[model samples]
Target: MKLYKVDAIVLRSREMRDADRILTLLSRQKGKIKAVAHGVNKPSSRKRGAVQPFCYSSFLLYRGRELDSVNQCEGIEAFSGLRADLDRISYASYLAELTDSASMEDQIDGEAFFLLLTILHLISRDGADVELLTRSFEIRLLDIAGLRPHLDNCVGCGVPVESETVGFSSSTGGVVCGRCSGIAGDVKFFPRGTVEILKLLLKWDLKKTERIKVPPRVRQQLRQIMQNYISYHLEKKLATALFLEKLYYHY
Candidate 1:
């Protein structure tokens, strides 16, 4: 069997046959790939820590026709903070799933690889704004996947929407001018500043997100807009997203 090495983050780990796991990994070199971790479920397996979801590790894999197999692995960072808190874990899982959903197998997405790595580090730190970070991730990931919403100009009329209020259409993929709002279905109207904030979230440095102060109302609006926008493009509600929603409402 041919062998290859890659540094990757475990996006998901699913139970397979006894003492084995099927892992979805996002690698810097190879994008997304699935592989089996034989015996990683056993109490004595050394790969246990490295194979868990959200662990960044170096993996030695034997290439198989259908799927790769983990030969040896070592954990680089366990992101222990995420595991320690329910909120962090939920948001982190959503991020991982979003990354996995947007990425294609064997396609090199260096940008997304680094984006997820950065987000994992940010969320793992104390006092991190997980909600804000997640909103940023959603917009940025959509952009990375070439599904960026039209923010600067109205999606329907091509007119720059500079009014205090504008309509956003998830189906139309961006903000709409007042005159064009009637053509879109399920339009949500909010302050134009909210649209500007979305633009900033897409272009601003992720590390500097803490500096921006968004009002509670704007935050809520952003969340709703992004949630709808992402679901429309992906064509399905993400499982982690549904779980996070329940977690939030239950609290």
Candidate 2:
């Protein structure tokens, strides 16, 4: 058996037979790995906290023909802030799921790994704006996946979008001008302010997002547009996203 060490974030963990757990990890060394941690599900298991979702941990794994096995592990950051609150947990879960969707097995994406790690750290802190941070994560994640939607010019007409109102096409992955709105029936309209903020979200530093306070209307529009855009590319709605929606509706 070949042994290797990796520092990783647990993206997902599912219980297995007799205290075992199947873990999906996004590691610094290897992009995405599926491994099993024996006895981690048991109450007496020392590795319990380290194997949970959104945990950043260091693991010594034995490579097998089918799947890797966790031989030893230690928790680096359990993100207690995320675990302690339902809202934070939902947001963190969305980020984890998005990262898993964007990553590929055995392909190292240093930028993505660090982006997620940084965002996780930010969202885990006190008084963090989890919703805004999540939006930033969504846009950045799409860019890293090479699915960034064009915010500058019209995707259909090839002209600059200077109007007060513009349409967004998830299928085309960009904004559409009034003249090009006929290109798709699903094009959603956005105010120029919302569009500008979306552009800023793409270009601005993630940490500095707190300075820009968005109006409630614009925020709702931005959320809907990003959700639609992400869902189109991923070809399915994220479970965490739906949960968050219901979570939002209740509050």
Candidate 1 overall lDDT versus native: 0.91
Please give the range of 10 consecutive residues that has the lowest summed lDDT in model 2.
Answer: 242-251
Give lDDT: candidate 2, residue 192: 90
Please estimate how well model 2 matches the true structure, expressed as its whole-model Cα lDDT.
0.90
Residues 28-88, model 2: lDDT tens digits: 9988999999998789999998998999999999999998999999999988888888888
Worst 10 residues of 1 by lDDT: 242-251
Q: Report the lDDT tens digits of candidate 1 across residue range 75-143.
A: 999999999899999999999999988889999998899999999999998888888899989888888
Q: Output the number of the lDDT-best candidate.
A: 1
Q: Candidate 2, which segments miss by more than 4 Å at Cα?
A: none
TM agreement with the true structure for every prediction: 0.97, 0.97
Error of 1 at 155 (Å): 1.1
